[model samples]
Target chain A: MSDSTHPDGYVLQAYHDGELNDEATARIETHCRDCVRCRNELAELQRLDGLLADIDAPELPRPVWPALNGALRKQHEARLGPAFAFSAAAVCAAGITIGILLGPVGKSDQSSTNGTTWEGPSSMWSGGASASLLEIHLSDMD
Target chain B: MTGMTDDQLMIRGAAGDEAALRTLIERWEKPVFAFLVRMLGSPEEAEDLCQDTFMRLISSSGRYRPEGRFQSWLFRIAGNLARSRLRRRKILRWLPLTSGHHETPAPGLDPLNALAAGQEQERVRAAIRQLPDRQRQALILKRYNELSYQEIAEAMGISVGSVQMLLHRAMSALKRDLSRGRHES
Candidate 1:
């Protein structure tokens, strides 16, 4: 019998896996041919590999596609929901802001006597008045 | 569709092509399903996790950089899910309410067929299940998934040397377990 320490079983796995270089493989092969213990270890490793390969994979259930599609749909909707809501809210907000700035469009025009100059209750509804008010507010913060 | 590579299909999938996503599913669901079944020991959980994995792939498509092979990335996702599920199961097992819940035999696996596989295979499966996570993963990726050491390392997020050492240790442990099982029998 040969010494087990010389060609340890750890390297045998590497050899079996074809991970070793040709020179190393040749050395192990030659040693195994003469050594009963290393040969048995090699056989054990092969047996393990065989057993694992034999373990078949089970079939996936038929509903996987529908379930996956449902999940994907939910994901897509989840992703789009907030953006859509924000956009709709933003459009509404802008419309309201502009409506407040413009102040009922032609309603104020008919009330003005000369109609040459547009005026409203606060005077901020007029374009130049609104810009000036914005400037004042911004400058005040500065 | 059949001629397209996984990455190519992934690109289409990222672009929101439903057909491309469906094709990708057809290509991958089996291997991924099998891998999960062996890892989780419960086909039901495996099936759920497998779906989750693809769902994630689609959702994160924009972020999908081909850092390595797509298969490696896929396994990485599946492996992470399996680990998380296992951890949850472990914690849940201690709770009185969940004590009875256990992994069942995979669906479609005949009881007679399973028994016909004989005692040795059962011992091998038991020993495999007993291995530490990294060891078991490395062994499975290499042996069953047919991944090279480099690919295993990529999927496992470990060094190549680590993968090599892990497999060696895993095999050593399995050998010991089998020997012990033989003695006991």
Candidate 2:
């Protein structure tokens, strides 16, 4: 069974932060007075906190800041030129591709083999491609 | 005094103010680098991520809403990146540091007494490095950055209850490690 009265987790947390008000503090202090295990755990944590703060921060070499600045500046420049951006180009390219693929359907005799596959546009290109596949099938059937 | 307020720097930075950006770098570079270096396990990778973190901040200037503290937001970013890096490496959740010197240096310890303090800081650092990712993150966020338990949970995307458990486990682990170290010495 868990230690229901003074479950160690939150008590240590509160004690370390100095967040406990006087009454809660008094209760914990009273408990620590008697409980060896809890007192030992709390003391270790306090010591650990002191040790960690003493460590020095790492120092970076001088040029790295300029390098970071250069990168940020470059990104900013790319963002500034929206018209020439690749995302914009991608959208335009996708629109054109979609238009070509879906712009015209069966309203005109554009794709049929028997119909006047459009005069100037010459439906022959599309029809020829389909006919080539059909020719292979016919030969195979024969 | 070393850097402008988070909101001030962010606003100026969004306006393309280079000086404001540099001020931020000067202020946050060490703690940020320290966290990344310890988490990523390489000074080189830490530096790269540090640069990348600032670059992101630069690009995302106005995106920082006034409601959130910049430090917490920045830490959340670091925590996310660190987690992804660990996950990508398929890391094992190793046992944490059982004991060592405190996370913070005791403020009142006289400089002359540094030697007698019997502290081997590298031992503590290595121990921290060995902690399971979540526990280490929780401990570092709490001790080094002085984040509240709720803030740590928020930064790490864990529940506050989970944060408490992780810290408790971490404390126990560190205590055990320290006792072992003490006995050996």
Candidate 3:
């Protein structure tokens, strides 16, 4: 662009994307019609974009259906009402089960809570739930 | 299935054709997922988010206008999801790509040994990731989505001038990077 022309990179991008208006596009085309450097640069950018087209997508995960399945099942389930209750109930059940399992595992060393040996990774692994996750769950409960 | 355009597919999808919906999803899922993966640098996250976009589409069946292009609509939803993720992080997560290998060879070079497409893809991905977010957006929209400047501007909520400037700057940076490749071994 000349001194009087637009200094904005956006206008140039518009030109590159072929989004410029007729007269403006005509003007830029005219410029490229004469300037070898600008023409070469344009050619180079096109080449780079072509090179970029070589970038293929990442690997698709296995069992991609689960996510899509949930979405699909929920399609009609929402109209029936209380459909999400099972998920909530499952969480509560799991919470209670985890508490029971951990309570026994922690006291297994004492041989008093079911008189079993503690052959676990340690008390740290006993808390299946992370502290933050526990706090978040408790906070939600409250 | 055979005669349907994208808009028709969306309309059919809206009318509860699971197959039509699946077809639509199949058509655009890869590119949108790729867009998200590159943007957020997490394939797992992108997969989750891509599923969410489709979920929204399926659930919002009645809301789509019959007149709009399904591709644009799908992209608008994806763009919104991407924008929300960006806003929450206020950061870029650039995953390196690994798929730029030439099948035969560089036709012009005719070298003895072929360059690995994976490494070339990685280099380009890294260079793109280093770009400022807006420039990256412009470049991705044009180069990946193949949207015109006006469409990209509309999608990005910017002017044509801004899009041009972003592309100009991005190409300049890319040119410099490409030149560096020449200077190295």
Candidate 4:
């Protein structure tokens, strides 16, 4: 219906799609009952929808999940691999510096002064020797 | 994991839960693939783009907000990829070597359908293909994907009013094209 009182194509489409509010829908429903033009327009829209629906997408092979997973894993590694390596390297460098600072001279000095046995970095890390080494190192700095 | 919503799955996927990602892929791959095929008019390209879409989803999952429907966000990604591929195809078509290339229909049609029905279906598909990109997208999202007008708007990054206008123009064009095809045949 192209008349001033009849719903336009946009309104008809909206009404056909159920997008109109209840009051608007009711108005259109009542109008369509007396209006052949609006009825045909609505039918045409439905028919076009049906025609499009008749064509289904061809059944292709399912996506290869394993390949996708592998790709994702590689992407993840590429993003984080360098950072992880850098962190590991930093940790190793810190450990080596600590070891050099607590070398044989530092250990012997601590042993002579505190009568606490000098232990390697391994023992220091194991909590048995760390406190005495820290005290000796602090005293040596003083 | 299967029972979880797409938003929940995306949240888990963002957190590096591979199973959640897998579930999301399994659930969405078909529909996304179908949408791509309709958009790109080639199953092979659709397959490639569909994979790309999921890859993108996982890569960008951390930034995904659960503010809208996951399906809308997902289709938006797929739609963008399809549009890019189509744009590339247009540029490539101008090349001398690729000038003669034509888009082929997706294969595997049921042979049992009557010949006339098959022809009609082809005509509709061809008519759909002839639609402008935005109109075709809006129409397909509405007709085939069954997205609401608001969802189509979100997927297309347009207002709802624009979506309605696109659909109206699309339907009018299809009716014209299909009717013209009938007369010529």
Candidate 5:
């Protein structure tokens, strides 16, 4: 067989691997039978495969599940930890803001209904408190 | 659960089913570890990376589409991690004081070689270790893992033609390397 007619190395390797389709396999088989070069190439590829097959993977020292499970658990917790903390902080902040907004209105309503202005703190504090109460009252009225 | 396919198990695993995850670990751990051990040449590192691969599988399972190619996807994750680990090892090899500590012994030199059993096997392991990473990966995936060309292409994220070429080059190199080893000895 001429050099040009012989299968390429990849095609020969594919043939050795049994990866070629039936038609291609037949073509290669016919060509290799007549071509010493292709036959040598296939033999060399098979020898290489055998050499590679001789090396075995070492045994695992122990079952990986215990350590893997632990790592996964830690990872799962690590993922949820920050989100859980953020959610709790958000809830706390919302609760605090709601208390701040509603506290003065209830207090002012009590003070007004009691007929005595409770001078519990400086006007600076009362002023801010009253401003919040006004905003709530206005919003309610609207 | 054991009868369920990898995609089915992964779907359950994504939904936080511990049993499915366990089943997956049981089913895949050995083959993955073997692949890693060959790729990285260290059973210790392979074991660690195998766990990491499954961990990645679970974490990414939510996005997994069941295409009957779970093994390819699983190996892709493992292959990426192995490549990253190899890169890190290369980088560490350049550092001054720590270089000695991080030197990768040929698999033949590994204490675990006692299990691998022969000097011939050791030479083969060392030859495999010397191949360029992509060629080595393609060769191992095809030769040891018994992946079809399409499956190897999927696992390595290369085309089937690329896989064929890699395997061709890899086998040629191994033949040359082994012949040299034989001549030297």
Candidate 6:
């Protein structure tokens, strides 16, 4: 295999594939004209090429677009559509969270300004002692 | 619409043109499916992957770069998807309980006449399948897809010289296998 007639089947294969430049193609053309072994090898390569090329493509199934179209449209919508929906949902959630959070802060601020006040939900403090402790802390901070 | 080039269609698709996307699918569905079917050797899987390929195209249209030929880009995506599927198949082949191997009859083949024709086709496919992955890909892109060596290089992420060498080696191996099969038969 190493000591074949042609040193490199490179040019031969290239020529067979028509990958060679015009000048190189001409050179191989001339070489192949006189060389029996190279010609035979070239023929074998061509036969292989033909066999590959002849592998038939399967008949395509009917247009798959109904599902594909739905999928693509869904994908397109997923890409373009969900983004707005996501942001809108995010904004609404943020608004609710902020309102809930700020409701406590707003009540705390109004009550805290009056000094020594416990103005949160009554459920937060279990005993009178706890309420008094919280009042003292609030008064100290104020 | 029909006269629009693929690139033009892609650009329109990128711009949110549904009609352009439809036209693009109509234009490329068969060719892409054919490429996938041959590459994967399973019509059912190929059909599924074919749809995925277009879905990917549509999804990625926003980032579409028209620097290269659209056909080459499309095949590059298909080639990548096929490679991933092959890798999955390789992993699945090892599992004991899984019936992972499915050989779809070659398209247009009638089971009655397929006895003879199918064997030959399967022989060629088997020989091709026996090739190292890159070599098989180089050969398929060049021979089956009719892509030039350069396009094959682009699609396979290799050099033109590598593409040439891969094809040469692939052909050499196929010739040996086919000749041996001929003798055996």
Best by the DockQ measure: 5
Model 2 reproduces what portion of true contacts?
0.35
All models: lDDT?
0.72, 0.67, 0.66, 0.76, 0.76, 0.72
lDDT of model number 4 = 0.76
Model 2, span A11-126: residue lDDT tens: 66677677566987887888778888777767767887777775655555343467885564455444444533444456558867866787675336445546432121212113
Candidate scoring better on lDDT of 2 and 6: 6
For every prediction, compared with the true complex, DockQ reads 0.19, 0.14, 0.20, 0.20, 0.25, 0.18
lDDT (Cα, tens digit) per residue for candidate 3, span A1-142: 5555332444555566677779988877877787676676667767887778777655556434446855455443443224334444576799678778889765555545464322312211122333332333334455
Docking class of 4: incorrect
Lowest summed-lDDT stretch of 10 residues in model 1 chain B? Answer: B93-102
Worst 10 residues of 4 chain B by lDDT: B94-103
User: In DockQ, how does model 2 score against the reference complex?
Assistant: 0.14
TM-score of chain A of each: 0.52, 0.42, 0.42, 0.55, 0.54, 0.48
Report fnat in order of the candidates. 0.39, 0.35, 0.47, 0.41, 0.61, 0.42
Give, for candidate 1 chain A, the lowest lDDT window spanning 10 residues.
A118-127
Across all models, the iRMS values in order are 11.0, 12.3, 8.6, 9.1, 12.0, 12.5
In the predicted model 4, the residue pairs found to clash are: none
Off by over 4 Å in 3: A4-13, A59-66, A74-142, B89-94, B98-117, B180-185
How do the residues B23-71 of candidate 1 rate in per-residue lDDT, one tens digit apiece?
A: 8888889878877776777777888899999888877877888554888
Better of 5 and 6 by DockQ: 5
Candidates 5 and 6, the one with greater lDDT: 5
- Sequence-dependent TM-score of model 5: 0.74
Residues A1-142, model 5: lDDT tens digits:
2256887888888888889999999988888778887888877887778777765555667777778776765565455555545555676699678768899766655555564332312221121334332233233335
Runs in model 4 with CA error above 4 Å?
Answer: A1-3, A80-142, B91-113
Q: lDDT tens digits, residues A37-119, model 4?
A: 78998998888878877775555466646667666545644455565556556766996797698887576665555765433
How good is the docking of model 6, by CAPRI class? incorrect
The window of 10 residues in a row where model 2 chain B has the poorest summed lDDT is B95-104
